[model samples]
Target: MIENYIATHLIDVAALAILCYLIYSNNILNQNRKWPFYIGIMLTVLIISSEAGTIIAGNANGDLRFLNIFCNVFGFAMSPLIPIILLAIYDVNILLTNKLLMLPSIVNMFATALSPWLGFVFYIDVNNHYERGNLFIVFVTAYILNLIILFISTVRTGQKHHYPIKAKFTALSLFVIAGTSIQLIFPSVYSSWHSVTLSLLLYYLLLSEFDGSFDALTRLHNRAAYDKMVNRLDGRKLYSVIVMDINNFKEINDTFGHDFGDTVLKKVASVIRKSFDNSSTCYRVGGDEFYIISSETDPVKLEHQLKCMTNNLEKERKNDGRLPTVSYGYSIFKGGKGIGFQEVLKEADDQMYYFKKIQQDMKKSTQTS
Candidate 1:
């Protein structure tokens, strides 16, 4: 038992040190008011301190009732904060900058504070061991609700912004649920905080990859990310390639200025993101060029999706009335180069040129005017 406590404490201490170093050294922690990162750090510290309390109580042969209560209180208070902090990290406006989101956490903390008298969360015995109270399930229920909200909010936010948020949030929620459930079932096992720390490390790695792979201006996958995807497609997965170009883009830039050109690009990227499903990835492969690689190679679905994008672009043109429009063409792999990825790209490029020519011939590009 003593050896287990020592190991858990050492791991928690090392994780906290690494996390502090990462926050200080990395700029991600500084962005978006840094509230998310601050909350994460605070949560980690609270867990670590709680673990310390546990160790102390154990060392005292459960004689330190105060220490045991302190540990349980900290743990209880962390339940509501976890979801709020995650929402903040994902730039949920209502949660991050406003005190409204803090209310739940504050309430939980207050209730946990009254645990000694009310026995609402947990109780410490004269021997200093901890046990759940009558209303202990209330806190557990709150945690479950928090996780569900986090999952739903993350999915909605991702869809609204065309971001792949599900990967990050899903993994995080699952880890927390699994870790905390195990700890709740077997309190003496003492593995919850360590599991959470491990999850944090994994999330950091994922965030780094996400930050590195996406374009800063347009928020689409960058050319480097495109190359990475191409490398991964070793002919095992069937794919269809869609290539797009903003018509009269150079003229739009020269006439409206670079800032306006940037807005146009953002608008087009937004359209592309909204038009495509999660099965496809959009990449900013060039200044005015984007490539959408769809895993679904079914000809009918590809055609339908392509037509939807075309109709969407037409609607966008109608809305803006004067801004330049985008032209796109897609090609399903037809076999060449022993695999045909490049063949599909070349065919898509050809089709894009064909599509652009037709558009120019039809409308004469309302852009220059």
Candidate 2:
């Protein structure tokens, strides 16, 4: 009976660990440096060890085997430490520069190494069956304590960062800790269903984090996220702004339909992405309009770049046999004009419409000639 129970828990734990690792891996691939992958790696290892211990404890008879005992001791002991490392990673301020956040991982490793001295936790006979002793309390208690500490840390870090997903993360952490504790204390609840529950929570958190800063259609920072970043920038830094509007975009939409109009917008967004450096912020402010902000750009160089881009866009339009044109207006802040951000943006907009009118008039005269 005990054998069947441990086997079930083993499978469930393994699945949860794998799901967690996938989430961590996805974040790393997306260039998110705040989440450390090592924490997931360690959790996976600990889960595997615990699963093995469960198998030994259930199947073996007579005495608890050394491997079985060691796995149980380390597995339960190591679980809580995983989230502490994760908390450190989530707190970007400390993780970005402060180095002391690495202590939990190091300390957990030492604890894992010393676990074998508890003979009562695991004893073995020739049949390889394992027997548990009274000191299982020590292993269980250590695991519980770690979970509590990590839970508190995660909550604190989430609040400090003002992460939108903070409540979700906090609730998931609490649920997992509660579920694990219940399973340990009341072995009857240890089942695959519990694992599924934990896995679902992790999956939701991962999805939230993945979509946190991006717009699904344009792959640019969403307005909400962009505002957050803008609020964080130093006021003294000079950031040049470029606002561009597609000429007669409404006519294009009316003629070709909304789908094709969307395609054009995407094409323009891609052009901006390719032209600007990684530091620039590009946003689609409205239908047929985009804003590009770049820091510390040289005015002359920026103007040359804008001209070159216009020429290239014209070439593209000719190749496509399309009549649409893109016009841009930008301003470089020399830091002493006493101009607010919105004021500079207004000036740029006026210039854009003025130039756009000139282009329209030139086209009309050419047709008349």
Candidate 3:
């Protein structure tokens, strides 16, 4: 029986072990981000092992009853935590900001801990037989709640980052849900950890692919991503392209430092991200230059979004006087015409330079006055 349990879990354990080695060897994530993966892998391992222990001890003599109770309690306490750890991987700040999210796990932990004595979650009888207690629903509820949170967090993160692989995330969520649900319903089948191991491996690969498309400094889509998006644009779909350049960027870099300039870029990127809706994609296409591609065809709405971006910059300036203003221009492509992307881009660029020239002339006039 113990051999059967080991045989069922051997592949999962080995997969996780290999993943842990790869994570550390490649230095895939920073220290802060890496710990969550490590913890998740560790917890899954513990849960798998304790579950096997529970089965083994439950079938043994009453002398091993203590072991049965310990294993059951440990497994129940740790099982609901896996989803929370997965959630942390996507965005640790979510857990930090929302303390209420932890309430169910905390309650489940205390209940499971006292279950051996109280027999409210699970109990091992004098004959060493394992049986569920009246309040076993506590563990089930906590696990389901955390899974829901994980699913919601994954979707929100994908949307915020404009991840093109949203279908993959959905599949992963459904995969885990199905695997865990099967085990929850069957009780005899051990499939949850197997599913988790595969999910973690896939998630790591997805993050690696997604991170490559982002600008490291500004956290916006990088030039390569921008080019890829431009090349892939459907000629039948309408697009509004907005090009913006920071005013006096060279002066800002020269007066302060490249560090301050980078900060300015990040702030501008944040403003752009907040100003635009999900229908728009923001990119840091070049030094001191940001680009926005919006699906919005309405000119008034596009103008309003641009105004919102500038207003955000003004608000940011109150905190840091060194922050520079931006001049922008936009061009609309109705598509299906002989007009190419380059043509649309050049029109926006010409207008942007014109806007910059006017701003420069006004600054000079004010100085002369």
Candidate lDDT (C-alpha), each: 0.75, 0.61, 0.86
Q: Please, what are the lDDT tens digits per residue for candidate 3 over residues 1-369?
A: 668877878778889999888778754343455779889999988888888887788767999999888888888998888889988977899999988998889999999999988888988778888778899999999998988888788788778776676688878888888988898888778787788888889877776667768888888898988988898886788999999999999999999999998899999999998999988999999898999888887899999999999999999999989899999999999876788888989999999999999999999999999
Top candidate (lDDT):
3
lDDT of 2 by residue, 36-113 (tens): 544554465466556556565646663656556566656555654555555444444544464454454445455545
List model 1 lDDT by residue over 166-231, tens digit each.
877787778888988897898777777777677666666655665667777788888988988887
Question: What's the lDDT for candidate 3?
Answer: 0.86
Models, CA RMSD each: 5.2, 10.2, 3.0
Better of 1 and 2 by TM-score: 1
Q: Model 2: how large is the Cα RMSD against the reference?
A: 10.2
Error of 3 at 290 (Å): 0.9
Runs with alpha carbons beyond 4 Å of true place in candidate 1: 1-21, 24-34, 54-71, 87-114, 118-120, 126-129, 134-190, 234-237, 296-311, 314-322, 334-337, 360-369
The segments of candidate 3 whose C-alpha lies over 4 angstroms from its true place after superposition are 7-11, 25-32, 117-119, 251-255, 315-322, 363-369
The candidate, 2 or 3, that scores higher on TM-score is: 3
Show how many residue pairs clash in every candidate, following the order shown. Answer: 0, 9, 0
**Model 1: pairs clashing at backbone N, Cα or C within 3 Å:** none
> Candidates 2 and 3: which is better by lDDT?
3
The estimated TM-scores of all candidates read: 0.72, 0.53, 0.86
Question: Least lDDT summed over 10 consecutive residues: which range in candidate 3?
Answer: 25-34
